[model samples]
Target chain A: MAEIPAALLLLADARLPAGGHAHSGGLEPAVAAHAVTDLADLRDFLHGRLATTGLTGAALAAAACAYAAAYAPDADIPPSGDGSAGGRRGWRGLDAEADARTPSPAQRRASRAQGRSLARAARATWSHPGLDALAAEVRAPHHPLVLGAAAAAAGGTPRQAAAVAAYGAAAGPASAAVRLLGLDPLDVHRVLADLAARMDEVADEAAAAAAGGWDALPAPSAPLLDLLAEAHVRAGLRLFES
Target chain B: MGAHHDHDPHEAAPPAGRALRLGIGGPVGSGKTALTAALCRALRDEYALAVVTNDIYTTEDADFLRRAAVLPDDRITAVRTGCCPHTAIRDDISANLDAVEDLQARHGRLDLVLVESGGDNLTALFSRGLADLQIFVLDAAGGDDVPRKGGPGVAQADLLVINKTDLAPLAGSDVARMERDALRVRGGKPVALTSLRERPDAPEVAAWVRGALRRARGAAAAAP
Candidate 1:
């Protein structure tokens, strides 16, 4: 096992101002449908989400991290930070992969919106050539790809990027549960604590999956989550972006 | 409104070659939407204007602006606050920034962008990174004591507007006391009192906005 990279904490921190706060990770629509009314229901929903979209997100992040780690220019690069054409093509392909994995158009929009915000925050914070190239190639790259590139920028491994992605997959919804359902914050956090080991396991699987090549990356789609996201868009009242 | 410009020397100058972003924030039902509409109607002829509304639940404010036809649909954008209105404007301003930039992208260059915040409590404020200037609106009906409370919004905002003055007598609120208390805590900042129903144009506030826009343009022109 490798030591944890200190920068992983910053990448995963909710306070990074990357527009993650506005997103509920499908928790809002779940609560609206009465699918998750309490901590127990929320626990089931989180576990289910972790098993599906969480795993897929982690795999995507791992792949993106691996790509950035391999291709990103070092700090000594010129001020222009000209990324190779191959790097830009790689980023665009990964972005298309992310879009393909996201079945729902609404979910795709939410992912891109967050991705754009994360790109701005990452470029400003890390000043990495890979992040700049990704931004240039895909105006709105998916969130997990930016997360992976940010991990690479922060000197983290693919496993670390997967872990951060996996954690956000559950944590974003858990926090939203507290606000939307008015659940006990402590109890909601306890739910996250119980699932911490599961998230790590998913991250481990994701890192292993990334090594299998981009075409072999996991594509675990949550049909119900897709429905919820679509419904969330046309819903009369909505607090979260997704 | 008066000519009392309280420019903080430490405040970062507004970014060059963009609309001067003005934020309007206050408690629920304090007439933020109304003021935004008024400002749009007042200034749209003179300047290229756009709006970004942080409506709590849905695009109510943006919809209202559209229905009122203050500006074209392309000029107005809505940003959901994810249940924490203050966080979108003050803590993590990315969503609002994205909305503003989207508007700019759609319409080339804009002279003004009004980012109306979802109704929040007195402590709510626009991050300096988001709003070049902020106006905290308080209704006379909420309570005259609200100004005396003087939280960050009331005390530190660039301009404070005591709105719904016409309802003061009906609501048994003292407009005089509200103004006095606001001025006391504002440290020489200007305050305006208005009734949107009577003066739909919000002439005094519009005049203040014109002056602020002029100064903002002058400053942006002066910047490197």
Candidate 2:
């Protein structure tokens, strides 16, 4: 019965101009490897991604939300328009923890790249100190951290941040599959629709784990996805950054 | 929850002491890259220069610049556009920004940095966030009516270049008509008519860029 922020839709909207459109979320490489060729293959790919990176990202976002909201009440200071994030120091450790969780250099770069872009968008969209703090503390906090901070700024709870993370984890790839493989838009939306319940379950797990601190956040890894990302960098042709 | 900010077109100044970023964008096969290379060759001797190219598929544009040896192997950085070259340059410019900043960091204090968009359509215009100024290139061979059918790239870009004028007579394209139409749509903004085949050095475009760089640096100095 918890309320979702009206602005959460904006944050999760693909049209928000966070530069996520230029990334296929590793689906391009999976397609290159012929691991995802048909609707069924894509569904399986989505399931695997939702279980792995999706779960990890949701936990990180939930943890970031918990961290930010906990600090928000006391930091009633005005926003820093000069791109400063004041009074929020807990984000850096979470960023480092994200670094440790991601072993592949390519994935780290991708995450940092997405993080930096998200920071710019979130700062411009929301006036919360958490965003400026995150921006100042972690010049490039992982994408989910910015998402979580943005969620908090939008007055959403940890569960909603987890949900946004879970949605992005699957949504970005589903959209990319349409572009890269020329798959039917309806079928891909159906695939995402079918995963809704499972997505909710994962988000709940992430939110439940929120109060346990950064170390306690979920740490799911997809080895094949990482390998595919590494391979995608040297790939002869690509439409996505990772 | 948006920030209370000015709606000024050039809001965020280029990173302190960073190179002036000039975007080159136009339709596929419009000679955007050719002009970029030509400008590079013409201006590299006078200024510390670099290029960031957005490619929809592969690194062909960057590769071409490298093959031509216009600046150097390292000065050219290629960014993937996820098949939407317009989004990378205009709506969501983070990737292109990263590429440009990376090049500027690697080679410090560049006088000019050209961010060339992947060959895109007339709707593709570089965001002011990415480029300090933008140049939209159109081939006269594209048709004399292209400027008449003005889009954002044709109208809003800081400079417009109607290139490939040598083929105008052969292609039956009236350069004078296109020039007149471009001037009308652009509200007296600067427009150049170029034939890269004859002027491979892109001297006129180079002069425009040099003036922009001087003004950008002056504005930065003029800033508080």
Over A43-148, each residue of candidate 2 has an lDDT whose tens digit, in order, gives 9998999898898889889878766776575755333221112322367777876777787889998888898888888888888867777888876778888999
- Show where candidate 1 strays beyond 4 Å: A73-88, B2-13
lDDT by residue (B61-173, candidate 1, tens digit) is 88999999999998999999889999999999999999999999999989899999999999999999999889999999888799999999999888899899999999899
Q: Please provide TM-scores computed only on chain A for all of the candidate models, following their numbering.
A: 0.93, 0.92
Candidate 2 backbone collisions, by pair:
A85-A132, A85-A133
Give the least accurate 10-residue stretch of model 2 chain B, judged by summed lDDT: B1-10
TM-score of each: 0.95, 0.89
Give the alpha carbon lDDT tens digit for every residue of A201-240 in model 1. 9999999998776767899889999999999999989999
Model 1, residue A47: distance off in Å is 0.6
Evaluated at residue B160, the lDDT of candidate 1 is 91
Count backbone clashes in candidate 2. Answer: 2
